[model samples]
Target: MKRKKWMSTLLLVLGFVLYFSVNEPESAYAMHIMEGFLPMGWAIFWWVAFIPFFVLGLRALRKITKETPELKIMLGLAGAFTFVLSALKIPSVTGSSSHPTGTGLGAVMFGPLPMSVLGSIVLLFQAVLLAHGGLTTLGANAFSMALAGPVVGYYVYRWMMNASGKQKLAIFTAAALADLSTYVVTSLQLALAFPAEQGGIAASFLKFGGIFAITQIPLAISEGLLTVLIWNWLQSYSTNELALLQRQMKGVKES
Candidate 1:
């Protein structure tokens, strides 16, 4: 894309993200586990689990910045889209709430490693500034939303693309599943932390998962549609960027 066009696209993406970032949140409650919500042991466990991925992601991110300097515009769009969509939290039937993962597009374009870094940055900012998630629970939140969702999205898109050779179908399915997967992991996290007296972790998982399903299923579908729309928009206006992504994608999964 031309400099003027890419700049315009960035402005629009940034504008949408900024509007929501500045908007007052509806609930003090939010999508991810809240501040000090997890036990210290679980918190530390999750933080430890998340660190390796973030470190690898940093390496992946550095490689991208150094090697494909031109694709930074698309990178910005991906980060902005994740921020804007994920920021829209809906209070769910559970004690907390749910929202779109918003990592699918980034995963599709730049792979999961890049999104691990981008998505964590999104979580970090939201935790500190928006009070949506928290510093203590950031690891749990990032693991579910950033790592799990994008890992699913990246592989699903690749599998779907190979099996069906239908870009839109692949994008929709991957994006929708990515959103749902985040809630699945979150439910598991919550379940492990607070097991039910009657049936233990299994029952608690069912309870949390069931409650999240009520709201999250529809949210995932809506996010899929929105992702497809944005994908189409990029296809139309960001051909150069897409071309760069195609080149990058070929090597993204290689060891």
Candidate 2:
């Protein structure tokens, strides 16, 4: 796809998501950290930590789109998958809602680097247009859902695939763990920012994590199954694209 066309497509998706956010009737506390919720030090730290990966991701994105322009559609699909899945929020314990990170499918398909860019873009626009997450906390949210989730998901798929040669299992585990990893990292972020007086960060992490576990575990599993279905659809319907993708992602193979 042409660069201009890609930008237009992205904007179109952005518009749809904004409309969904604005017209939605129910409001629940966001699982995403709100604006100005984190301390300045922590917020800046996350931004600093997240920037290097995003920079590397930009390079990777450019290389892929320039090299094998066909995957542009696949790229857009991955981003849209994330936007759709993550936009779904279910009420949960505490003040926040639980939802799938939806990074695993893309991470498994395109690897983690490019996904960092896509996932971060999702978080950025959500923060700006939806007010779902805050600009100050975007770094933290992006780090958790984008960088950390995709890394865990991608590697888990690689490891599972290599070890067992089971594609379905690999995809499921990657998606589930990827979904879980976002919440885990987010829990850690909350714990770090607000450590328990008696138990400190570790104690607080367990507490924060415990709160999210109620909803996140089931949501993760559901996301995993849903991703497997999507993977199957692609495998059956887009054989040529999968073949091209296999070539693009070195070391990926069907077992």
Candidate 3:
């Protein structure tokens, strides 16, 4: 990126956002399902489903710490990024708003398993301190935004990197697509729990997905750009540290 290219990208994303916001009626702020909005069974199910990922992330974190204690600060900063970015809700054309997950950067940098723990903590803090999401729906939210998004994002980035050897392109694609993936999983969760009377699960999923895409797609594009900018800055200033992380990742892969 050149400055002109960057401006063009920003303008395009802004156009999408403005088009949706102007076209659709103002809606409720939404990212994770509102606190305690899901049925008890659904909530419990998501919690159970998320437990394995959470535990695996803890194990991964422990391993990383034992190997590279210097990375702890980086991990903390990544978690903070996720928390802060996700807290900013973009109103959508649908009745609910959406926001960026900010998990893709962590997934690309530290790997997805570690991000599961990082993302879970961010989500937890948001629910408890900010009242953005609910305790009861934590599991569902964690499953969708934390585990699912990061897993897909990590693989997507890796795949793109391997194929193109273009870090910026890979980062943008991973971040944007991962954000979309989170909402897709979220729509599925909502559909499964509350199927529409006419079209059932499929119909309900489309309804939810269409609604969230209004805000989410543009937010995803914006997040992708932001991630690239931040990563480029870090790469320029922290070349040695970034190399160390890359070496650690290589070591993990070899093992």
The runs of at least 3 residues in candidate 2 whose Cα sits more than 4 Å from the true structure, single-residue gaps closed, are: 1-25, 251-255
Q: Alpha carbon lDDT of residue 245, candidate 2?
A: 84
Per residue, candidate 3 scores C-alpha lDDT tens digits across 1-255 of 556655665666556445434543344556788787899999999999999989999999999888888888778878987887787677766667788889988998898889999998999888888777799999999999999999889899989988999989999999898788999999999999999999999999998899888778778888888778767766765677688789988887788
Taking all chains together, the TM-score of candidate 3 against the true structure is: 0.88
- Candidate ranking under lDDT, highest first, comes to 2, 1, 3
Q: TM-score for all predictions?
A: 0.89, 0.88, 0.88
- Whole-structure CA lDDT of model 2: 0.86
Compared with the true structure, all predictions reach lDDT values of 0.86, 0.86, 0.84
lDDT of 2 at 219: 81
Please write out the lDDT profile of model 2 over residues 1-255, one tens digit for every residue.
355654654565455446435533387867788899899999999999999999999998998889889889999999989988887776676655787788999999999999999999999888887777889999999999999999999999999988999999999999999999999999999999999999999999999898778978988987887788777767766788888887888743341
Each prediction's RMSD over C-alphas, in Å, is: 4.0, 6.8, 4.4
lDDT of 3: 0.84
Note the residue pairs that clash in candidate 2. Answer: none
Clashing pairs in 3: none
Task: Please provide, for model 1 over 12-46, each residue's C-alpha lDDT reduced to its tens digit, 9 standing for 90 to 100.
Answer: 65654454444424664776898998999999999
